[model samples]
Target: MTKFNKTLLAAAVALASTQTFAAGFQLNSQSATGLGRAMAGDAIIADNASVLARNPAAMALFDEKALSIGATYADVNVEVTDAQFLGQDLGSIDNAAEGKFIPNAYYINPVNEQFAFGFAAFSNFGTGADLTPLTEVEGTISPVDLLGNTEVATINLNASMSYRINDALSLGLGIDLIQGSGKLSRGSLVEVEADGWAVGGIVGLAYEINENHRLGLSYRISPEMQASGDIMYLGTEFEDINIPLADIAQLAGYHQLTEKFAIHYTAQWSQWSSFDSITLENPSSPEQILKDYHWKDSWFLSLGATYDINDRWTVRAGIASDKGVVDEQSSLSIPDSDRIWYSAGFSYNFSEKSSIDFGYTLVVGEKVHVEEKNAILLPIDAYTESGANYFSIQYNYTF
Candidate 1:
């Protein structure tokens, strides 16, 4: 590999290792009905079997067997402007944040009046980024190797059971089978790929104040995910690197003010604090310290209202604000910032036992100024603009 490409690869790894995309590489497009309300009351809204993925305790609200299948498409746009490297102008470049389709499915069956069992297949986190635009700079001797792509994907399979204590309370427990994989490439100078599986668990509780009000709380624990794979860099191979995921906690409330109108809210916290740094080790050589992410915990809040327009149609609207995990450690690879969500949707009940839900969301992110310092090259100051539009549709059936 050319020396110029080598340096560029090093710089790319430094920026990409810690932050990939979607608010520190976490995905929020899990449910179509939930997205319609910006995920408001995600844990307490037991309108369908999708609740099994969000809060298993909500399964107590079901009296019959049900199934839910859905898909969400995210169209993301990101741009990096006014980038300077070693006092040289690199101009503006747009990142390839292509549209991604995320799919989900769930099944729930009631064993008795007070017991329910459920299974779900869903994706909780994912990201992909292409920086090929950075390779077209006019300079001949590129001091950095930022010409590569990175991608990460994960799927979660869960089995859960809920027990209704009485008319007003319920409890739930679940086990998660998480599958994950990742790939990073830097112009043939460095290529790394890995895949793994991990075990986690979820616990939840739900309380009903009356026919019109409900409250729910849930927590998810993520086990350490170790990816055993080979890495080829500079004509050398390294094996068995580890990657860790984070846990989450959620609280939600649902209130029906009248027969036709209802309101809901939620508060969610992600344990991003657990991700302090990115370290890659080699058995025969020194460790490669890519970055010190220094990310703090993150929070999300959402508020929504539902209006029953008619017997067969229901409309919903919502708003949400999500706090960024990286306060000062932002980079081009992630470029995550505080964001707001505006959403709207409608559900059509085709029959007593079947329904379809459609939702649309617009995500707007705050502009961020980044100043990344490099050991081999001068510091670069850049401005980033990021946003996304999401559309989703879900089908629900009850028997």
Candidate 2:
């Protein structure tokens, strides 16, 4: 590749970094009940089959077959303002991010007193944004290589099993099949489309201190995804691309202080430091680095409370703090920042074996200043703000 072409390709790839709803590119829309509680103690809360999406060991708490189905609609808003290239105005963009609906399903069955099985379908990562109009500013030279449309999505299908050693402890293991797809383009200079699959796993432990208190710990191993499609590096094309994903670890606790009141909390960590870079590979040539992230690890902390109002009504509320993963290296494409979450929800029981849940959450992000170099090495500066509203509904049945 020529020097100019190489520079252009590197700039475009770097700016095409994933922009998502949660910290890094992770997704947290797996269950409506979990969302209502900001995911606090989700790994140990076995109130419904949705627990299968977090820690399968919780399935041991079930004595009957249970099923849960839910979906979350996320309305994302991102504003990019004060965009300039070497003092020349490049205008601003409003609502660059797109809204999406995330769906999930789970099933759990208890076999005998010591064994259980469960299955779940959900998503852990996704992103969508379009900033291409920033490149169409009339008067000045635009940062065409740094602004574009980028979308990424992934789905996880899991099969899990749990074994109860005794009344106090349970162990669980799960295998995951992940399907992912990505699309990115910058005007007429760059375009990439790819889809592929990967495999990963999770292990969990659930400890019950008593009938009213419990603790859970889990770790998820993620794979370095490789996809094949039309990946253009300048004028050259590559057969495949490799993108590294991060592992996750979480610890949660639940306490029932009163007959009708309960409290829960969670501490979760993401190993984003391991997501160092993206690489392009071809059979005829050596592997090449497509982009470097150099991101840091991140944490999410949540606290929640649940109360039973009546025989048929239950209410819950939660709060959370999410630390951003991006450190010194930041880009206009990502617009990453620290965030806070406020959530509330309710459950209405129709009968002893059936119920419905409704949840809502508001995610607020801090505004941040971003600076990056365009294709011609001209520095571009902008201020970005991102936020979202999540509405969720779920149906749960037990037999």
Candidate 3:
């Protein structure tokens, strides 16, 4: 690999590692209905087919055979400003992403009245952004070019089971295997390869209190993704690096104010603090690449309400505050900060066997400033990004 290409790859990892928008390293676009209420108790409620993406314990609620398949379309817009190179106006443009389609599938069956089992698949981590115009910047690389327009994708398969301990109590467990891959391009180098196997587990408990209230608690253990694939620059090898990802934690509850309406909230904590940086370990030369990052831990708090409009239609709306992964050492590669999400969506049951869903969400941008010390040998005086708008839709089926 040429020296320039190697430098770009090193910068790519450093920048890509700090980009964020979802929980831990996962993106939630599984069920359109799930999007309506900001996914409040999606696993515990199990009202629609998307329940499979939440707590496998929710499978217990599915008394009959059920299957849910869904797709979400999202329109994202991002903007960066206050950029300077040696104190010059480098200009700015919208880094917004193209509309993307995210899909999911889940199936559940009752072995008996006491036990239920299910299988599920969905996207966890995804990377998408536009940086074609960044190349024109002088002396400074957009960091976007080093990581390509898109950088990461993760697919998860979960086998779960739920057991009803009593009329008022239930317990659930799930084992998952995750697969991931990414397309990385920097300067004149591009690398594409499959990341390795990762193992994780999920456990949840739900309790029924009286007739007006219900409670739930769930914990999902994250598995570290250890990938082994050739790091290619143009046509040459640039030695591989070991990337370690973070885990997830969620706690939620719900209450019914009326027969036709209900409200719920969720608090999620991700161990993003475990993410410090990425290191490229080379055996031949006993040398390590230069790419260090300082990322802070983040959290999400969501509240949502659901209204049963009719037998075939339900409406839901929610709001969420997602903390930023970028810290004081943030870079041009990830020009973002904390965000506020306002969303609304609905579900229409076409029949007892099938349903379709749609959702729309707007994310209010946060005020985040940029400053990098060891990158590009310069410090950014200030940096910030405007918010984004998103639209989502999905289809759910049961048989």
Top lDDT prediction, candidate number = 2
Compared with the true structure, all predictions reach lDDT values of 0.76, 0.82, 0.64
Clash counts per candidate, in order, are: 4, 0, 3
What value does the lDDT take at residue 271 in candidate 2? 92
Task: List residue ranges in candidate 2 displaced over 4 A.
Answer: 1-18
Give lDDT tens digits, candidate 2, residues 246-355.
78999989999999999999999999887788787899999998667888999999999999999899999899998888889887766689999898999999999999
Give the lDDT of residue 104 in candidate 1.
96
TM-score per model over all chains: 0.91, 0.95, 0.86
Cα-based RMSD of the predictions, in order? 4.7, 4.1, 4.5
lDDT by residue (tens digit), candidate 3, 1-399: 111211222234454322445533346556777677776656567776566666766666677888777776656556655655456655565553555667778888889988999888887666555444544676664433233454555667888899999878889999977665555555554454434556678888777775567777777776433334656644556465544455666767778899899988877777766666564545675535435556677787889999989989989999988887766766666655777878899888888777777877777766666655434465443455655455566766666
Q: Give the runs in model 3 whose Cα sits over 4 Å from its true position.
A: 1-13, 16-20, 23-25, 137-148, 189-197, 232-239, 284-290, 374-376, 380-382
Give Cα distance to truth, residue 87, candidate 1, Å.
2.0
